[model samples]
Target chain A: MNPKIAAYLRDHAPATPCLVLDVDRVEQNYRRLMAAMPLARVYYAVKANPAAPILDRLTALGSSFDAASWEEIEACLAAGARPADISFGNTVKKVSAIKAAHAAGVTMYAFDSEPELKKLAQHAPGARVYCRILVENKGAEWPLSRKFGCEMGMAKALMVKAAEWGLDPYGISFHVGSQQTQTGAYQAAIARVAMLFTDLRQAGVNLRMVNLGGGYPVRYRAEVPEIDAFGDAIMGAMAEHFGNALPEMVIEPGRFMVGDAGVVSSEVVLVSRKGEDDPVRWVYLDIGRFGGLAETEGEAIRYAFRTPHDGGAEGPVTIAGPTCDSTDTLYEKSNYRLPLALDCGDRVELIATGAYVTTYASQAFNGFKPLAEHYI
Target chain B: MNPKIAAYLRDHAPATPCLVLDVDRVEQNYRRLMAAMPLARVYYAVKANPAAPILDRLTALGSSFDAASWEEIEACLAAGARPADISFGNTVKKVSAIKAAHAAGVTMYAFDSEPELKKLAQHAPGARVYCRILVENKGAEWPLSRKFGCEMGMAKALMVKAAEWGLDPYGISFHVGSQQTQTGAYQAAIARVAMLFTDLRQAGVNLRMVNLGGGYPVRYRAEVPEIDAFGDAIMGAMAEHFGNALPEMVIEPGRFMVGDAGVVSSEVVLVSRKGEDDPVRWVYLDIGRFGGLAETEGEAIRYAFRTPHDGGAEGPVTIAGPTCDSTDTLYEKSNYRLPLALDCGDRVELIATGAYVTTYASQAFNGFKPLAEHYI
Candidate 1:
């Protein structure tokens, strides 16, 4: 655990199983991203840690927002962000939400199908619309399945349809995947976008922007490249592909901007052995899959855990959350190792968990309150 | 969809992506269980669906409750249930929750660990306690992982410890698993509990009760045997193992009692082809994994879906939920076949979803409201 975070926990004595976000770290992360990619516009994805304080801090730092629903647009507006600075980034949106977003003065939106384009034209006529092109997201830690984007043929047709339907064919957008680590994935996606841009221009549709959707990674259990490395690779790829005709570039980062800035402190509920000869012990914590850490779905994303009892001899342990549901077990297959002395009531800090924890917490499962969030 | 539920939706026109619970069906399910297992007391597991109306109806029907937390106990109380009719059934519970349950006059509780017994001694002394013995949970649809119970030796030790700590060693409890279809699994678990009962009696810890934990299956996609088959198997096993020495028998049933009594009505959000050559068409619903259908975790539990346009010849489809997350796809791997005429704005009803859908819904993800529930 970071000494600063430990001290903050000690000083405030906030409720256990609560999320603590370090505002200073968030600012530093924001500044680092801005400094690394000077030419690209930053739109912090609001679905990640949409706590008012995080949004206020980012809004004060002049960060734009990538909102998926009208509630997110309202949240951004309440945090003092201009509607022009918010883009409705979800390709699949409710028609009423589209009208609400348009009426709220939000103009930028994303779509991937002809039906969605028709909905956009019906609700948000003359809105700046971007068609997302599907890209191969093979190397991402959390590869987005074919849930969001469209093929090149469909994308070209959607852009043309948007123009005919009286909506501005603003640009193109693509998400490599969440927690994306490989820079080559971005390069490959950009290359695909460049080819599509040429094809769209030849078909008489002028694009003005390119949304490199959020997938930048954070250092959790695995080592990931720094922001500067990704910035350099993206800049080089854009230059190599589009040369001097690079459109206004924008990046939507959810995990990278706030992942390292927050830590979740949970109390150990129980420490027991399943059998006498069992090699690994089971450690149950107050927070779980439903509490906040839903990203541990299939154990694809592993968060770094710490106990104050660290530095003792390490032993293999299976960690679980405090829920009656069987699927609440967190690291039964991941081979998580914790200090031998860790027991019930010991505090375990899950570091780099700021991004996707809070908003995903179930309201009340088994009557347990959702994981509370405490801002530092 | 049940014709009654379809008519209910057509007449009421409740919001889309909402759960419609059939109260009359719930009562029928309760009566059917009562008729099947006359010797066993039924405790409706409150975690399944703790809706106030359901609880009130069940309470009026003189149904006992299996509460997992203090809030559930309170919910039962508010629904007019006596404290003596509630059992604190979760093995892992907060110390404060134990105190609260004890203070609220709940006497029967379940525990499987030494630390939990010590907490019970501290806060709920002299309370009736049961030790949940670990059992083979294979062959069930949703197997209870090693999160709940202890081995035979540990169970014996725990009962001795509970007696020593001034708590009544009341019973032994074991859950076969949720959606447990095999009646033999219940017989096996009962036989193990009978052996433990003999051992505990030899150790001078005479137990008075036995809890056959919740696992009874409900018909969704697969056909489940009638409740009478399970009752006959359980009674035969008890007669064979403990012959006329059956203690005060109690059974907790979550899914079996209420699962088939509810239908979730959701509007089709989008129907688009990823590629024209792709065989499987994508059907997106207004609700998703976070919205309440989280039991689709691994596509292990497949709920039967009905479209009003159901008879137009079936075609393969990949069903997805309306969330920005890629993991929200519900039935890509489950081989869901829907009517070819199903399109956007059409209604789809997920049957047998009354048990675990609403309470597990995340509050707000991607700005979409959690699945709403309406009791009919």
Candidate 2:
């Protein structure tokens, strides 16, 4: 734990199982993304963690938002997001949400199918819509063209139907997938979507928006894509492909925008030796699967742990949450050592969990409520 | 989907994500277990799905509860669990919770350390306590002996300390681990804890309770252990080894009691083609990682999805939640075919999710809330 974080925690009310945001880190990250990708419009994906304060900060900085559901739309509205600036990027939406978006006067929504078009026609007829396309990522490792968009062959047909229905399609969009490690995946998607744009123009469909759905990877581990290099490659591709004729480029960056800026601090409840041969150490903390830090099933995401005062040392430990489930392990193998052999009542901070952190945390275990947010 | 379940969902307010209990299946499962080990007292682990209605049904069937936290304790209490009938089995606990349990007059609070003993003494002085031993699974595929327990070497020392402190140390307890598929593992754990009890007796610590922690497997797929056979093997061991001298035997069955009783119904939002390889079908429903149905890393648990209505003839389709994260796939491969080539606005049920299903789920992503629950 950082001394500054520990001090802030002490000053604030002690709330375990809460999310803590480092405002400075978030601001710097926001500025860094803007500086690196000066040409593209950064639409902060609010589905990651749309806490009011965080949303307000990002929106105040001129960051547009990509909302998936009506709840996210309401959150943006509550956070004072200009209705026009909110993009309902979630393609498969409820009629109620579509009606709500229309009622709220938010214009842009992502549309992928003909049935969706019928729903939009009944609900938000005049909504500014983007034709979501499934651009095959020939260069990527895990292609996400599985859902969310129409394939290249269906794209023009879908667009033609939109034209036939008197629905004015505004642009084209493609999502490379979340947690994309390869920068080239974005380039591959862009190259394909760009070609689709030209094809749509030839097919007599005029478009203005080119939304590259957000999958800009946050540095979850040190091995993830470098933001600057990734930014440069993507920007260079956009400039080279569309030049000044590029439609308004929108990217929904969720985890990339805030993952590293937030940390979850919790108190240790029990310390026990797990087994004989391994001499496994168990540090049961208040945060479990319900905490923002519960990503342990497949390829457990390793989180960094440290004490407020370095006391000069640490050791190998397997951290488990307070839940009795066997799968409640936070870290299967830890990299850093604790300042001392950590005991119950000691506090620990899980770092780099700002995005997708608390948004998906459960509140079932301890009566510990969400944490208090203190801006740095 | 099951017409009854579908009608139940349609009739009820759609605000709740329910854990559907098949009473016939549950009662049949209970009968099978009882038939296998008629002499053993089966304690359903309430932490799996602590909804009061579900607990009421389990209680009506004459099953005790294995509670891990104060919340579980409260649930058990609300369901009319007597203090002597309940055991607070979490190796770790909060002092306030300990005080609450003592006040509630629940006596079998399991403790793993002298520190916890001291805390219990201060909070619930002379509380009837059970010592938790961290026993090793000599040979098992999925070992859980790695997380929480006092080592065999320290077990005697902690027991001695408890006796000296005038705390009534009742007996020994060991958790084989959750989702245990191996039947021999329980036998090994019982033997170990029984020996630990004998050693404690020799060291002048007389005790009665011998708790074998819950890990009885539920049939997720074909590979899971047969519940009746598993119960028979464990109870038979106790009856043969300890005979009339066997202490009050306690077994906590979490997933076993409620796993197959529940089903999650979700509406398919969109189905599209992936690429030249296959048609990419995505059924976007209202469930997310908040539900235990979304396995740890968004990988759907094996056998997590089962349709209520046998779409008589079926086609391969991927069922996924509506979360924007690419990892939010519910099933990588379809187990069976759909009744028809499905389109938008279709609801399907992910069957056999009663255990660890939720009224509690991650509240991340659009203020994600749990669906309304029902008792049918």
Candidate 3:
């Protein structure tokens, strides 16, 4: 357990199925990412965990934000972030959202398709807009390369059209994927973006920024390469591609920023077997997929667990949530083993669960309360 | 469109991404189910969509509730359902929830394992308990046989122990699975339960009330066997196996009760191609997997759509929600097609979305508001 979270749990004993995040650790992560990529501007992906404390801390640390919608942009603005510092990063934007962001003085926007770009051009005229290009999602545990971005051919046309449509052809962006393990994924995507920059520049678009959208991996059950590795690989690729005339580099780090900084403390609701001789015990916890562990779908993003009786005799377990819905089962195929001594009411901490857990929680699914958050 | 919902939509012009559900349709569905299987009592599964309006309407219709948690029990009670009319149906429940439900005068419970049975025995002393035995989920779109239910042998032992543990070993229960199409699945499950009842009776333990847990299917994009078919098959199997000394029949229906009674009204946020010659258009809606369409995880529940120009020429489409996350993409492999005339801001209705859509919505994921709900 994180010492701060452990201390908080021991001292205060907050309710189970709540997230206890260390805001100071978030600061440390911000500083680490900044140190690793000094040339790149940090835009904390607010959708990861947009708690007031984390947003306030990041804003105070002089970090910009990659807002997914108008509400997120407003959240950043409410946290004292300048509108110019917040990018409306989602490619698909509601016209109302575009108008809201524009009315709020938010300038930067992302789009892949003509319709979305048109919405941006009409509503947020003269807004700095970036085209998100499609890139492969090879090594991401939770891939995001499918739905948002447009093809390179389409991106090429969109950039040139942006200027004609009364929007700033500010830059290009591509998310390699989320929880990306291989540094090569970034290298390849950067290469692709560099090609788009060259094509757009030749067409007189002159894109000036490169948004290396969030894909930085954080350690979970398995070891991931250090943040320095991603930073090194990305910078090297940018250097090779841009050759000192690098555009303004912006990094959206959602999971990397907050994932490892928080822990989900859950109580074991039940632990029993299918049959008397069944080898694997079904371990039910207070938290599950709908309770903000949505990333556990397909057993991707496997999370490390901490039981009260860790380091004791272990047995195979299929972990599930405390819901009548069977889909709430978390880890069934994954070879999760827990202490055999673990029983009902025993608290367990799901480690590195800051990002993507809170907001994704169902609003009282099965009438269980949404996951609670306590940022220290 | 359901005429009532269509009329409501025409009159109210409610915001996009709202669920317009007709409570009269719910009453009609309940009446239809009761007419089909008058021998069985209807226990509306509260987890499906526990909106107060639906619960209130069901309560007024004299429908019993199958609550998944303490909060759901409270919801049922607040909707005027008597405590005795509510069954704590979740197999894995917290002790606190058990105590709460028991204190609220809820006597009926469901359990799958010894640990859960013990929790019920200790917390809800003398509570009428049923053991959920696992059965095959061959044709279920949303299968529940895996995460819940125990082996038949274990359920047998647990029920015998429930008596010793100071609980009413009232019955045997099993879910064929959610959205169960083949009535034969229920027949098979009934036969299995009947054998268990005979064995228990021979062992001097008479078990009454076989709870045929929820799995009744409702129309989505495809046709399903009518509720009458399932009712007839189940009753036939019960008579054949139980030899007219029938156990009290109980059925829980989540989706069938309200799935077809609701429709989700969304707007096209964007409609564009990935590339110049890309054969498929990516239709981005204001709602996606995170916005209550979570059952679209594997393209399982394919919802029929109604666009303004639904009868117009259609093209293949990959549908997604308006989130930065790629996983929010709802239909990719499902070969879903939409009207070619669809454009940004056009209203579209996702049909038969009443059951599992509302509560499954994320709490402002990507800062998009939760799917709005209106019960008329």
Q: Each model's TM-score? A: 0.97, 0.87, 0.99
Colliding pairs, model 1: none
**Ordering by lDDT:** 3, 1, 2
Local accuracy of candidate 2 as per-residue lDDT tens digits, A279-334? 44566788776555645444345556555545765666667777665566766654
Q: What is the Å distance of residue A272 in model 2 from its true position?
A: 2.8
Let me know the DockQ for model 2: 0.41
**Distance (Å) between predicted and true CA of B5, model 2?**
5.6
lDDT of each: 0.88, 0.70, 0.91
Kindly list the per-residue Cα lDDT of model 1 for residues B1-376, writing each as its tens digit. Answer: 6677778899998888899988888899889998888888999999999999899999999999999888899999999999999999988887778888999999999988888888889889999999988888887888987888988888899899899999999999999888888899989998899989999889998988989988889998989888899999998888898887779889999898789889999999888777556678888999888888889888878999988887889889989998889999899987889988887788888998999888888888887778878888
Question: Which regions of candidate 3 are displaced past 4 Å?
Answer: none
Task: Write the candidate numbers in order of decreasing DockQ.
Answer: 3, 1, 2
lDDT of 3 by residue, A203-267 (tens): 98898999999989999989999999999999999999999898999999999999999999999
What lDDT is reached at residue B185 by model 3?
97
Which prediction has the highest DockQ against the true structure?
3
lDDT of 3 by residue, B128-166 (tens): 999988999989998875788888778778878888888
The candidate that achieves the highest lDDT relative to the unseen native structure: 3
- Residue A148, model 1: Cα distance from true site in angstroms: 1.2
Q: For candidate 2, write residues B1-376 as lDDT tens digits.
A: 3455556666863543455666556666677767776766777777777877766776777777778788788888788877777778777787767888889988777877666778777787787777777666543333464566777867777878887887788877887766677778778778877777778789988877777777776655556767776777788777766778978776777777777767766666666554334644556666755554544332424554444445455567676667665556666553534554565665656666777656346655565566656667
**Alpha-carbon error at B332 in model 1, in Å?**
0.4
**1 or 3, greater by DockQ:** 3
Judge candidate 2 at residue B55 and give its lDDT: 67
In candidate 1 chain B, what residue range of length 10 has the lowest lDDT sum? B271-280
